[model samples]
Target: METSLLAFLLISLAKVIVVVVILLMAVAYTVLLERKLVGRIQNRWGPSRVGPFGLLQPLMDGAKLFLKEDLIPEAVYRPLYILAPIIALGCALMSIAVVPFGADIRWKGVDLFEIADVNIGLLIILGITSVGVYGIALSGWSSNNKYSLLGALRASAQVISYELALGLSLVGVVLRSGSLRLRDIVDVQSTHGLLSWNFFGGFQFVAFLIYLMAAYAETNRAPFDLPEAESELTAGYHTEYSSMKFAMFFMAEYGNMITVGCVATLLFFGGWTSPFGNLFPEPHNAILLSFLSLFWFVAKVFCFLFLYIWVRGTLPRFRYDQLMGFGWKFLIPVAVANIVVTSFFIGLRLPLH
Candidate 1:
């Protein structure tokens, strides 16, 4: 029993290490992807000289950030100011533990994919993500600067408002799938084929759109990035932060974007299900199917990520009042109405055509 437990522990640790490394790598490339894509959008070449079209740009950027001087303002709340970004990055990393990479395959009688297959996976993700807001709020308050505090306040308000819409928009998916388990949701989507994906139906497509927009605001991405609106708040909540500490916050933002994109893909685009269903069904081809499904999943996520970069270059920042009004008046109402309509359909056991 002791030997068995040791083996189990080592396996778990290995799985965790793999996940963390993958997330870190993804975060690094996401930055590069944004720079390149945004540069294209703005009609400029981005970081090509760094190392082979800037393939090494993230590495160089990371090195520079690490070597930079760390600064903390004298008036700031020392403890909380330092702790906030750590909390933000920690929470962001926690969500990925529950995310399934691909269909599970047995390896020595153990599932080789995903660290934990918690039954309430969706709830875990939502709860972890929601807690990340505290990081932003605390950072702002601890900064001891007017602009930082204002940015934090804006961030808090934005997160709270958009979270409601984001959560509500996903209810349709939960109701239709009849399970809160992320893996189960994917299984159902796979069984239903292309048309069965939540985004295929009209109402679900609207929910997906709402969810996407709200997610962008929740993450403080472009147009909705009022918290970091340079013109208004200088550098916003983390304006006073520098060096590695500041890099933590930057990494967390991109990490959260990838997380949201993955969740959206799983919920609306079929997590790891092939686009055309079992059109080429073969009992022994489950592994092949899984690969195809994962390919489609990654492809969908990449498109969303590209959209994020595109919007960052093309759109202008929203006015404070306009941002607040849109969330409260437009998104919230639409999300609420969507929930009601979806519930009605669910109650009637309406078959999705």
Candidate 2:
């Protein structure tokens, strides 16, 4: 028993280390991705001189941020100012703990894809993500700058306004799956392949659309990035931050973007499952099967990320009032209606005794 417990501890620790390192690296490169894509949208080359095709740009950027001087303004609130970015980035990283990236395959008595298989994984993600807003709110107040305060306020308000819709949008998925465990949700859709998927088979496309829009505001990307509107608020909440401190907020945004994509893939896109369903024979080799699952998961996530970049490059930023109105008056109602319609259909499909 003692040996079993020790093995579990070691495996868990290893998973944490591996996932964190990979997530941080992904966050860095996502920044480079945004720059390259956006630059091309404007007919310009981005970071071409850094390395072949600017592949090494993220490495150079990370080094520059690390070597830059860390500065704390004399007038700023010291404690919260330092803690804010930590909270932001930490929450962003923490929410990924419950997300499964592949099938429930085990190796040496350890889950090969996920860190934790908590039953309430969906709720945990929602709770952690909701708490992340505090970091933005506190950063603005602590910075002793009007622009920062305004930016933080916008973020706080924007999150509060849109989060209701985001949470409601998932109700359709939860109702369809009849389980909060993300793996259970995926398994439910796996039985019939593509036709059984939530977006198509479960008829939850409305929910998917709602979730996608709310996710944009939740992650503070372009069009919904009112909190960091440089035209009006300069550098926004991170205006007073420099060096690695500033980099933390930058990383947090991209990290949240990745997390959002993962959730969307799991909930609406039949995560890690092939669209062809049972058309292909399952590979007998466990390692081969796991690799295929990972490939599909990564490909779906990349599509979501590309959509994010495409929208950012093509759209204009929303005015603050328009942002608020769109969330409150538009998304919320549509999300609620989607839930009602889904519940009706689900109820009809249940066999009455």
Candidate 3:
């Protein structure tokens, strides 16, 4: 028994380390992807001098940030200011623990693609994301700068307002799947290929739309990025943060972006499942199947990330009042309506008692 327990612990620790490393690498490349794409949108070359077509730019950027001087203002509250970015980045990475990236294959009697496959995986992600707000709020409050405080206030309000819509958007998926376990949710969608996906067959496309908008706001991306609106907040909540501390906030944002994409793929798209359904034969080889599953999952997530960048380059940021009004008067109501309609359809499809 002791031997088994020790093996489990060792495997779990290994999985955690691997996931965190991969996630950080993904976050770095995602920044590079955004910059390259955004540069093309403006007809300019970005990071070209750093490496051949800037392929090595993320590595250089990481080295630069690491070498930069750390700075802390004298007026700020020492403890919370120091703690804020760690909290933000920590929470962002924590949400991924329950996210499954590939097939349900096991090695050494442990999950090959996930860390901590909890029954309430969906709830756990939501809870961790909610807690991440504290990092931004604390950073703002502790900074002792009006711009920082204002940015933090905006972040807090924006998150509070949109988080409701975000959570509501997932209700239809949860109801349709009848399980909070992410693997179970994926299993339900795997039966019919693209049509079985929540975005299509399950008729949760409305929920998916809500999830997208709310996710953008939650992650402070693009038009909804009021907290860090460059024209207004002068770098916003992290304005007072510098060096590695600032890098933490930057990494946390991208990490959250990746997490959101993962959830979207799992809930709306048929995660790790081919869009063509069972049109193709299933391979008997477990190793080959695992690689194929990982490919599909990564492909879907890449598409989602591309969409995120497209929106960032194309859309204009919303004014503060407009942002608030849209969340409360538009998104929240639409999300609620989507939930009700989904529930009604789900009820109709239920077998009589």
Against the true structure, candidate 3 has what lDDT?
0.94
TM-score for each of the candidates? 0.94, 0.98, 0.98
Per-residue lDDT over 190-291 for candidate 1, one digit per residue giving the tens place of the 0 to 100 score = 765787788884249889999899999988999899998899899999999999989999999998999998899889988777777767673467677567
- After TM-score superposition, what is the CA distance of residue 321 in candidate 1 from its true location, in Å? 1.3
RMSD of 2: 1.2
How much lDDT does each candidate structure score? 0.87, 0.93, 0.94
Mind giving the per-residue lDDT tens digits that candidate 2 earns over 211-315? 999999999998898999999999898899999999999899999999999999999989998888989888889989999999999999888888999999999
Error (Å) of candidate 1 at residue 2 is 15
TM-score of candidate 2 relative to the true fold: 0.98
User: Which residue pairs in candidate 3 have backbone atoms (N, alpha carbon, C) closer than 3 angstroms, thus clashing?
Assistant: none
Which ranges of candidate 2 are over 4 A from the true structure?
A: 1-3
Please state the error at residue 44 of candidate 3 in Å: 1.3
Candidate 2: 10-residue stretch with minimal lDDT? 1-10
RMSD of each: 2.7, 1.2, 1.2
Question: How many angstroms is residue 281 displaced in model 3 relative to the true structure, after the best TM-score fit?
Answer: 1.3
